[model samples]
Target: MQYRKFGKTGETVSALGFGCMRLPILNEKSENIDVKRAEEMLNYAYEHGVTYFDTAYVYHRPMHQGISKGFSENVLGNCFQGAKREKIFYATKLPTFVIQSPDEFEKTLHESLTSLKTDRIDFYLAHSLTKQTWDRMIQMGMLEFLQKAKESGKVRHLGFSFHDELPVFKEIVDSFDWEFAQIQYNYLDIRVQAGTEGLHYAASKNLGMVIMEPLRGGKLAVTPTEEVRNIWKKSQYDRSMAQRGLLFVWDDPAVSVVLSGMSTLDQVKENVRSADSAIAGTLSDFERSLYAEARKAYWNRTVVPCTGCEYCLPCPAGVNIPSNLNIVNELAMFGDVTLSKGNYEFQPPSERSENCVQCGVCLTKCPQHIQIPDHLQKLTEQMK
Candidate 1:
């Protein structure tokens, strides 16, 4: 695996970090993790040179059936049993949703350390932070808590994983004397959450920039769209869609690490191979144009630009806007709507668009200004 300088830390980490949030599970249960399978993949990745492992409080967390909050630190801790712990960097998060009090900070911090079977975390972040969470963190004395953690030697680095608008993201970045940051970025999200603008802005300040969804949650890893294929066919270099997605982020020298939640040994092998080839400014001017065209073809796919931002939430009528629009997009993104439609239709009418009340409240809230009621109305008719 290739390595990069982690911002101003003067420390080096693998170009590809292993995201342990999606380990293979047994019996279709999130808690019933198929550890043996996971160990093989994790070991393969580690042996090949991946040095950073990222997990979170809710990773593998099961709030309901067939769902995963995926508190993956447990698996990673278990996998790194015995002497395996000293070989790499361990990164994880403090769940923002659980931060209601100052006392909860230490409680969770210790719990995380215990779960990982480690005394200290290399990188600790405020997981999935939004404007509200940022304010609450300060109101509840997050600074004191982090300072204590650092002084106590429980946390080596401070960071945050963001999921908000650009302004809010920058606000949080500037508010804290943070060491690193994790963001959901990819070729497809150039103008979405914490887009390229935020990426470069954070990097300019020399924050160790770690990217979570470099492939847009695996959407960009699939076979290309016809338009995308046409563009790729013109390229002199032969690369998989996943490689293209990953390389786009690595092309920028500012990015420190890219996280891939590999679920299989094959994925581990494939990603490590890509990481071995990653280099800054590897994409030539022509290839960059191809990237532009590929991104355009991606947008042109049968999917809404609704990025599941959840800004327009708590619908009075109980409509699940993100899920519906995402499924709608999957009609094109995955090239098949059978599973999407099945899942969408499986939701009770209340959770589905049939409950849209046409209040227009969500419209003003949406960053994309998506006509929520209209989209729901159309989806209701189409799904029926």
Candidate 2:
């Protein structure tokens, strides 16, 4: 396995980190983690030199249960016994959305420390910080809290995982002296939340940039359309779709580590093999251009131009406009209604596209000028 200097932190971490959120689960329940299977995968990753293990307080929790569900840390504590725990750099997040008071900060940290059976977290983050959450955290003295965490020896490094506009990301990065940060980056998400500009900005400050969703929540790794497959065939590298996606992110010298939420031992093996070749600035110009072409092929299949900006939200009829449209776009791009329909059904019954009442309230709000109700109606018809 290859290692990279984890920017200004002066620590060397494996190029590939094991993200424990998507561990194998039993009986189709998110919280019902298949412990034996998950342990096997973790052991495989560890044995193969994946020293960075990332989990969160809410990783495997049921969405309906909100932030209260936190079984991931306990599972890790259970799996890594004795000396195995000391060698791994455990990275986890504090559930920023649920903190009701200043006291809750220490309360959550203590709970996480106890759950992980560790005295100090190698890296701790403010989980999934949006602009609203960042504002709330600042008002709650979150920066001081992080400083205290490191000072108290409960956390070695302080950082955040982001999901907001690049300006908001820059604001948070500049607000505190963070050691590292996590952002969603991939070939497809170049211009999305904390895109290339944000990646470089964080790097410019000498902060270690940990990349999450390098596969776009596993969409980029899934079986692609025939157009996308043909484009991959043109690559002389002969890599799998998953490796191609990973390599694109790891190719950047600014990326300190790429986290893959591997659910199976096979995935662990495959990703570890990819890490062997994760040298920075290695992709040829021809290989780099393929990603751009593949992106266009995927975008060409998009039926709705909705950028998921969430401006057309709080649908008067309770429909989740962006989510519904995203499923439609996923179906169009990948031609996988079976998977897309499953995702659509996963949303609350109230948030389903079928709940759209054609209120026309969202009609004027959309930035893309999407015919909101018409598309929701079409989604409802297609699902039927």
Candidate 3:
């Protein structure tokens, strides 16, 4: 396993961290985990050299009937129960997004401890902080609570995971003496939330950066269009689609760890192999050009380049403008007609793109001034 020092902590963490969100499920019919299978995967990952495990409060809730629920944290606790806890760094978040008052911070922290079956967390984050939550944290004395937890040995490191604009992200980064921070990053999302700018900003402050959705929620690995596949073939270096995507982030020294939510033993092995061979500065000029070309092709074919900034928000008719654009973009970029259609159709009729009342509220707010209502109508027509 390749190791990198975590910020200024003098602790070396694996370059490829194991995300516990998408562990293998045993049964097709229940939310209860197939413990035996999960154990095998976890043990395999540990043996192969992954040392970082990330989970959250709502990780295993039954989002759908066929999905396994309420087993991630407990299963992890059981899996690493008797081992030297220091050998592995376990990171989880305090669900501050759900808090209504100051007391709830302590309540959530204690609950996370109980659930993980650990005395002290190696890294703890103020989960999914937005502008609103950041304000609340100050009003509720969250920083004091974090300091107390650190002093009492309940948390080894304190930080946050972000999902808002760059300005807010920078504010949170500069707000505290943080050990590290997490952000959503990928090749296609460089200009989106936190983006490349945010990554460099965190590194400049000497904060360890953890990456989530490195694969864009598994979109990067699935079947590719002819144009994307052709671009990959042009590369002189041989690598899997997943490896190429991972290397893009790993190539940047600013990124500390790239998290992949692998569910199978094969995935674990493949990722480990990729990590072993993926050195900094591994991608040559030609390879970088190929990737850039492919990305350009993808953008040209499918997306409007909307960054989900919600600048065009507050649609008077309650239409989710950005989401509608994304569905259209995915359909055009990936050519996954079925997926695009299914996601659109599953939306409640009131929430569908067709529900737009064309009141122009979103148009006025749009930074891009996109004709959102017209785009939504066009998207619905194409998708249907």
**Top TM-score: which candidate number?**
2
Per-residue lDDT of candidate 1, residues 1-384 (tens digit): 789999866679999999988789887556777889999999999899999999987787763443334557888898897777888999988877876678888888888999999999999998899888888888888877887898899999999999989999999889878889999989888997898899899989989999998887776787755777899999998888888989999998889999998878988899999999779888899999998987777678754778787899988788888988876776666564455566676565578988887999998899987777877787778777
Model 3, 256: alpha-carbon shift in Å? Answer: 1.7
Query: Model 2 — which ten-residue stretch has the worst lDDT?
Result: 62-71
Q: Considering TM-score, where higher is better, how would the candidates rank from best to worst?
A: 2, 1, 3
Better of 1 and 3 by TM-score: 1
How much lDDT does candidate 2 score?
Answer: 0.91
State the C-alpha lDDT per candidate: 0.84, 0.91, 0.81
Tens digits of per-residue lDDT for model 2, 1-384: 999999878899999999989999988888889999999999999899999999998878876655684788988988886799988899999889989899999999998988899999999999999999999998999889999999999999988999999999999999889999999999988988999999999999999999999998788888898999999899887788899999999999999999999989998999999999999999999999999999899988888998878999877898999999998898898787677877887788889999887889999899999998998898898887
lDDT of model 3 at position 127: 83
TM-score for each of the candidates: 0.89, 0.97, 0.88
Ranking by lDDT: 2, 1, 3
lDDT score for residue 375 of model 3? 82
Which regions of candidate 3 fall more than 4 Å away from where they truly are? 26-31, 64-70, 303-318, 338-384
> Model 1: how far is 305 from its true place, Å?
6.5
Q: List the residue pairs that clash in candidate 3.
A: 60-70
**lDDT of each residue in 173-196, candidate 3, tens digit only:** 988899899999988888888999
Q: Give the TM-score of candidate 1.
A: 0.89
The residue pairs in collision within model 1 are 58-69, 59-69, 59-70, 59-71, 60-69, 60-70, 60-71, 61-69, 61-70, 61-71
